[model samples]
Target: MRDQTDTGTTEPIPSRLLLGYARVSTDDQDLTNQRAELHEAGCTKIFSEKITGTRRDRPELARMLDHLRPGDIVTVTRLDRLARSTRDLLDIAEHIQSGGAGLRSLAEPWADTTTPAGRMVMTVFAGIAEFERSLIVERTRSGRVAAKARGVKFGPRPTL
Candidate 1:
């Protein structure tokens, strides 16, 4: 008769438990849905932030990063919640990758750094973000030039 269970001959599926991070710019935004989504996505632990993403200090995000260990996975409902700027997003991604962890974005289904295609997508996003920044800089310059042409002061006025 064959044994019903394996005699310690089976391999584990590499515990890929998900860790969730959620953020909202203002208190007005509801976090109920975000928490539910993270739970549904298999998040054993969820870290939430209620402050603006533009701020240099995000206590929840900081705590999440510190808590993460190698071979773990971090998830977010959307990328914007994690980072507001392209540079910030890229920085965070790099940090996660360095820690031997992967990032998954629920909203951006294509953003799964665990696959080759996902890495490609991230590279493309970096390029697009750089282009967007350049365009903004150019537009600002043009606007300033137009304003000056209309006799608008660029700086504080001199006292008489």
Candidate 2:
């Protein structure tokens, strides 16, 4: 039997399980809304925690990642709830993909990795972001070189 996903696209879902991830930055923040949203999205189980997204050592995230099995689908209310940055998201997504799991972002439809089109979009985005980073580094290096040529010294201003 073909399973249907929460996206309502009837796109031939292959996963046997749906898991959700919800996160907040602080104890003062509530996970109620995110939990409810995830439930509405048809997640059978949800992993949540209150921790700053800046730290890459989130325990709950790691736990959820480890809990993944083949043909499992991970749903998130938003991509930001899952990762701190695009690179972080891509890395996590790659890990999930490597384990035969898929990722779907409720807010960002294009970020879904369950379809060929979505995977292509993510791959292209990764390449573009890398190229942009390279260009930025090149420009910064050139600027530094030009500044050095003009005798603009870098580093500390020297002892008083």
Candidate 3:
């Protein structure tokens, strides 16, 4: 995204942008502290929402992701406020990376993808999360197989 001048000139956009994202699980929750923290962190724009993290469709979050540009950093008050699970976080992080932006959590420095070390840490975490998910799936399959062998049934109960 380039900035255009009045004289028909085009220049690269701002050196960088610290775009903040604040979320609360419910409407009754307050966003004051998150907003203040982001402002103090030099964020020029902030996107906020009052929705559960478990929901995949978040309007404000989607808007923020769409607004991302190269050299933009998405800041969150905490990782849990952005995603409910590791896979969710990784998916959102992948989207941000694909948009040429970075992600940073104020409360979890290890989750930042702007720095080399932080990126490595996140990569390692992603790998671990994937392995854990695979293990869980395997265990579930095995459990189901064993249950079926014992004459245990699955699915909803029969209707009249």
User: Runs in model 3 with CA error above 4 Å?
Assistant: 1-14, 155-160
What order do candidates take by TM-score, descending?
3, 2, 1
- lDDT (tens digit, per residue) of candidate 1 on 35-71: 9999999999999978988898999999998987877
lDDT of 3 by residue, 11-73 (tens): 887567999999998888999999999999999999998998888899999999999998899
TM-score of 3: 0.86
TM-score of each: 0.73, 0.80, 0.86
Q: What is the lDDT of residue 118 in candidate 3?
A: 82
Clashes of each: 0, 0, 0
lDDT of candidates 1 onward, in order: 0.88, 0.92, 0.91
Query: What CA root-mean-square deviation does each model show from the true structure?
Result: 6.3, 6.1, 5.1
Sort every candidate by lDDT, greatest first.
2, 3, 1
TM-score for candidate 2: 0.80
